[model samples]
Target chain A: MNNKVPNNRAWLLVLPMLVLVAFSAIIPLMTVVNYSVQDVLGPNARFFTGTEWFESMLNDSALQAAFLRQISFSLIILAIQIPLGIGIALIMPKRGWQASAVLILITLPLLIPWNVVGSIWQIFTRGDIGLMGWGLRELGVDYNITRNAGDAWVTIVLMDVWHWTPLVAMLCYSGLRSIPEAYYQAARIDRASKWAVFRYIQLPKLTNVLVIAVLLRFMHSFMIYAEPFVLTGGGPGSATTFLSQSLTTMAVGQQDLGPSAAFSLIYFLVILLVSWVFYTTIMHMQKDKHPHGGA
Target chain B: MSYQLENTQRGEKYTTIFSKVTPAQRRNRNARSRWRANCLLGLYLILMILPIYWLINMSLQTNSEILGSMTLWPQNLTFDNYIGIFTNSSWYMGYVNSMLYVAMNMLITICVALPAAYAFSRFTFIGDKHLFFWLLTNLMAPPAVFLLPYFQLYYSVGLFDTHIAVALAHCLFNIPLAIWILEGFMSSVPKEIDETAYIDGYSFPRFFVKIFIPMIRSGIGVTLFFLFMFSWVELLLARTLTATNAQPIGMIMTRTSTASGIDWGTLAAAGVLTIIPGILVVYFVRNHIAKGFALGRT
Candidate 1:
């Protein structure tokens, strides 16, 4: 550990990456910033409009509604997927080929493209042709994701869970696997009940993984586009129209690039800020417990 | 030599407290447990397989069969749908284009991420931790928020429809992930190796390429596979960034429902085909998938 190398060399290595990233990332960000402050009449026509788009985006009722709906959807998805994922992980076989088989099966859904997931469900949930719709009708449920707002909400939430819970379960499974056998043996010797073992040992050990799972699920679900776009098209009276859908509808469909760009920057900042808070808080917790910054 | 342990205690009326379990009864109990386990596992397997079975079944059936028949299994198994996709015009190109960009993105991500991760892992540079976390913020940011900027930016740069455009845009997320995964692996490596190389007059670039990279080869492989898979399956940005010449399979699936009613047959076929590369990558990296979820390992 007697290394005394100058750290300035580190920047040299990171410089190319930074430059490339800046070209694609930072420069575009600045362009968006520029556009948000101005207006584009056509390809060759433009005019400066300071804070106009930002003010409008702030007061836009549609954007507000979209934000609220997106927040609620994200919360609902997190509520359902986290517990369901943990339950599924807990019930998974402890060891052997059966465990491997279950892992592989669970991973299959995750490997499919998001649009394909939507298409599969879209076809599978059709009343006349899709199995879910047909079966629900036969069972007297009268389900139509396209017609009913509540149904659309349920369908979107369910689809999100189906697609994402595996990620949570996978993280939890790895966390569980890393727990030493000695811990389980100790619990057994202490005559800990199964519930007690889970509550006291397993849950505590799963904190970091679950924190990561929650943050990841929140970010991805909040940003979701293709699946919901395909499945609902932000329809049923805009019930499933989340923030991303709203932005797309404005920016691309309606060609309101100014407001959309402003909204997007704000949206990006919210996620960045929230993620930063979560990350720093987790690090602080780790430092408090480990006293060595978890290194 | 095994002792039977039961949760229940015998009543006081039981005369023989230490009664030996009969071999037949023990065999019956063992058989019952095994049967129970088998039944539970079999049921679990069925539930897991049914939806996938339905997907594949739908993919194989003709449009009429999918819409007209409620049969769980295809009545007449046909490869026409699958063939319909590849033989049709401009359809198969989606797969080729997606593969090309995904590979390019992975290559670019690894090259950028490896050195950045090495610097973050091995050297305590100024603003290192802050920069690392800043990169992570990019990783966590939603792609939708950046779609407009990405499009305009790429368009202005005259790279909007090019393969490199999508690949580089994707690096916004993948580079951060690659750095994180690689850093995790590199930090585990002892610093003594680098010091020894430095003492031997080996430069940083030479040491990193010839020595350090080989040591973290598995990490690189896993990161590459992950980057490839995520970029391959990603729909929104890829769709936004590329147009005719570089459209991915995801965009092709979207285009299925055009002026006509849904191209259900072709859509199904493309949907099935789109999953092939992801499945192949997952198959290759199945063993190391668990390692990437090492949340508490640090």
Candidate 2:
């Protein structure tokens, strides 16, 4: 509950940000919208296409497959990363050199570019010279990401886990640190079990950060590219192709402006709808606990 | 000890009587769990470092050595890969461009976001909630969706391939986050401070700079860290926006492949180099890192 005051002059403060963001977001979004409705044949030659692009895009079996694949990937990463990150955070040292070392080292994967993360995994999973790939082959597991769709999916998920789980851990660690030491002592004196302590004390304290972590992870994973693109190039089949690759292939690669623009609109709408649901649900949960009037 | 003192001060007689015998047993359990915690953390950290270790291993070897066989360590260790990056303008300038734009984006984002964040935290204005949500829609908007429009938008203004163009385009994403984080930190500041400053005859701008800003410096630090992260790590937009002059290091690494083959060693070396700036940024803000990540309304 912020208990914020009402002041119309505050709009003056927000005006600059609005202008800058609108310049970047609104103008381009309008361009996409324009393209979506018109069949752009050449620089000046165009025809009104109505809802044909949207109709076709909706009906297209490939786009539906990509949409389903996108949803599954997002769900899988969130399921794996959230709990794993929380576990890592709970066990992390609370203070000193070890803490700083762990914090920095944990962030190494996040610092690398998405494409390089892709490249790193690409090389590391190679059967010939790569460590994990060679090691797997040596163990006779038959791990070939380039030729196997299942292997490609597994590697992409692993790569994402490596790249992003640190973010969740960092968020949870911060949440945990904010807790007062007195709570732990009180729990200890009561002879609370470890699981009870976590369930009662840590989880409630971690709610805010966990919300942020989940929303961020969900959005980022839903829009994931570059890594999977470089690692398996959407691989052995179109099996690994997610929404972004499909859109990029349509929008930029094939230069099909009308349908790609329509796809972009629908894709943006799906994300907006999902996040709206999540945001409202979270807000409702928080409201029940604190019961305040303002944000 | 302080907790024990507080317990005794509260006249917690039953707790004190029972807790005496449990201390030794509890301490033993604590130590054992601590040991377990270390083992778990160590194993996780090693897995985290495995790919990085392999990258460093290859970066120190020649291309031929990398391709010839798999080795845990370099056989004929060399610095040619690193040397190539330093000696060449094309290679090194990519880093310069990336740092320049990242810094510029961070500066712009924080400046605009601070006032807006203060506004969001302190005052409810017209369409503020709707405005904030709309901005986040940009955050959720896929960069791939904006790819073509961005290229043309910049091109039309003759800002194409400029660092500022990349910086501005990045604002579409970073500003929303900056505002979100700063608003959280700013709201933690009580309304009484603003009123008290006004009572003392402090001007709005002066009070904000002298008092409000410093109070939320940790938030600002974390905001900078995240802004740098998103800007630096984003390739799809950065790569699309720049051609040659303002090419980011990520763009360079992907483009490093020659006709003969990809320069595996050089690419690995460049990847290693990219991680350095991030580490340095993090080190400067390490002490504030934990306090900083509490970036949402409670």
Candidate 3:
């Protein structure tokens, strides 16, 4: 968008990132690729299994279910967080000591370590000791995450919303702030209604930050593990055993490296594929961005 | 882009030209809307703080008090949990190790990502788009998937069980994020800054260090804040990479369970301590972050 100049020599600036990232990313990735195609019984024992592990993992019903659950969870999160975040951002105090205070208060939930977030929620939701749990029961609603799948699902979703909505809000808030005052002044001169100004000016301007927000929330929710692992331990049954939880069980708990590695590649591909779709579709909606038109 | 925005503005001009509102009426409506917005925001902040308040309550209470009926406030308030962490080596050392690696990761990520971001924002080099997308895929790569591979890779390199090992592993993710956010911020700065600086007879590195970096200081602050957050909260790689010597405070919180069963009181106290560092970091960058949030200038 900046009319970015074409210059291969610019790679010099990118070299440090390339080297550091390659050392950390490429090596581990190759190892995963190597493991995905073979069975290693021990240090020296290896059997080249070809795509057998990938075949089995793709056909596996449990992995299939976890994949479906991951999709639904991500959708539900986006559906709630995106619009709610925009509303909060729109309402956020523009500039003052008030803005600073609200920003810090809103960010508190995001700061806690994931597992500690789990622990805090764990004690905070007990019927005997937790405020929410006790207050619910005292008001005549039966609730227990350890016993009910529905309750477990609700708690996880609620906890996630509590922890993550601030991120969405913060992203949208920043986007809102970036709009120059002249645009609003022009709207006022035209006698534009608030809704007209929002629809015509603010929402279109928000597209870039919204893209980042949506993608991040999707990716982070997809990789979620610690909070739920602690909160429900994959629940009353396997009700809330998400993709990461499943993968960890297979890899660490049961030590099924071949299938797990194959599964990992598939998992990575799904995220990449979905993200690519999302990125393209959102970018496509604003076709004016590419003045050169489709090649 | 300008043509399209103007076109939209023109379209909207026809839809509401007849509506005439007095200035006083507009002010009245603003005050009313502002009140409603305040109400919603206030309610949200209260809900957000509830769980945190509960955690603080548990931290201040004695063991017996925690297990007893839910009290709004800790009746039998005690500071034993806090004292235990301060006096003990294992507990406090966890904080030390966590802080060490997180600080290292922040420094490494920022130093590496800044120039890369400048390049991405300013140029269309060969494979630039593909390279940018590939780096982001690192962020999408599940840390769970990388656990075994990371441990084996770090261990085999003989960098295992050291703070540097954890710091480097985190760079695999943090550097990509820093680059992405920094690109957004850098692109917002007008190109004239670069052209003018170059024309002033400044060498590339001197211009970058002297003028360009200062202009994007807010972006750098936000990037540092994020690096601190992700590195501090992440336990899987940190745990897998370091066993004893470099174990973080998060690991200690997980290990608090003993023969008497998990020490809820002590665990809560440690959780509270972990949050303090984040608060300090946020406070330091509060204003910079506010400016950094407004990313799309052009």
**Which candidate tops DockQ?**
2
Best by lDDT: 2
lDDT of 1 at B242: 87
Give the alpha carbon lDDT tens digit for every residue of B1-298 in model 3.
1121221222343333433543454456667767888999999999889988988899999888888667899998899999999999988999999999999999889998999999988888889878977988898878998988998898888999999999999998899988977887887778898899898999999999999999888888888888888888888789889989999888888877798777888989999999999899899888877555543232
Provide TM-scores for the models: 0.90, 0.96, 0.93
Q: iRMSD per model?
A: 4.7, 3.6, 5.2
Q: Give lDDT tens digits, candidate 1, residues B1-298.
A: 4334221111112223343665456456646655665676566457555555667778788888887769877899888988878796688898888889989999898888888877777666777777878788878867777788888778987998889998999988888878877877787788888889999999977998899899877777778877886787688899998889998888877777888577677787787777677777766766666666652142
Task: Give me the candidate number with maximum TM-score.
Answer: 2
Model 1's number of clashes is 0
TM-score of chain B of 3: 0.88
CAPRI class of candidate 1: acceptable
Tell me how each candidate scores on DockQ against the true complex. Answer: 0.47, 0.59, 0.51
Q: Write the per-residue lDDT of candidate 3 for residues A142-171, one digit (tens) a residue.
A: 999999999988899889999899888888
Candidate 1, RMSD to the unseen true structure: 4.7
- The ten-residue window of minimal lDDT in model 3 chain B covers B1-10
Q: What stretches of model 1 exceed 4 Å from their correct place?
A: A1-6, A43-45, A293-295, B1-49, B196-203, B295-298
Q: On a 0 to 100 scale, what is the lDDT of residue A238 in model 2?
A: 89
Model 2 off-target regions past 4 Å? Answer: B1-15, B19-22, B296-298
